[model samples]
Target: MRPGERAVLLGPGEIGEPTVDDWAAWSDTLPHEVVTGLGARLHRHLRPAATTTLRSL
Candidate 1:
């Protein structure tokens, strides 16, 4: 994705406890060039608004 492109994550309560092995596993399953952590606090703060804005954009 481009520099300004927006992304959101969905999972089964694993966002806060992500590890190196989690990333490595994601790398194999995701189609993107990279897969990185989105800390729980930031994810929680932005999830609602970000989803709306991203859809409109």
Candidate 2:
């Protein structure tokens, strides 16, 4: 949203060291356009759900 700002993609594994193959396989299943769209809207998609006492991990 600002100049020089950047985004990082991490997941499919633990905090310290995330696995790469899992994410690669999953991405391969989706179209390039869809993946690009998700990258742009990643914040909205990862937002916490409302009305939750303690949501499942």
Candidate 3:
């Protein structure tokens, strides 16, 4: 991997939710920028005219 390169992973679909405290604890350990960036990038990639994701950025 190199700078500006992203690695995406797909998780299982049948997962259960955690308790409020557990969810809070887990979320506290994450990087907000990374989470939001991935979401924004995915949204761009899914746009109706997004034929080539390479330029989605």
Model 2's TM-score against the true structure? 0.22
State the C-alpha lDDT per candidate: 0.44, 0.48, 0.40
Best by lDDT: 2
lDDT-superior candidate, 2 or 3? 2
Assess candidate 3 and give its lDDT.
Answer: 0.40
Positional deviation of 46 in candidate 3, in angstroms? 33
Give the range where candidate 2 is weakest over 10 consecutive residues by summed lDDT: 10-19
RMSD (CA, angstroms), candidate 3? 11.8
Per-candidate TM-score against the hidden true structure: 0.22, 0.22, 0.20
Tens digit of per-residue lDDT, candidate 1, span 11-43: 323456554445657677542323334444553
1-57: candidate 2 lDDT, tens digit per residue: 687575445443444433344455676653444445555535642545354466354
lDDT of 3 by residue, 1-57 (tens): 998774333222124434333433566744443345445446333224334335331
How close to the true structure is residue 2 of candidate 3, measured as C-alpha lDDT? 100
Ranking by lDDT: 2, 1, 3
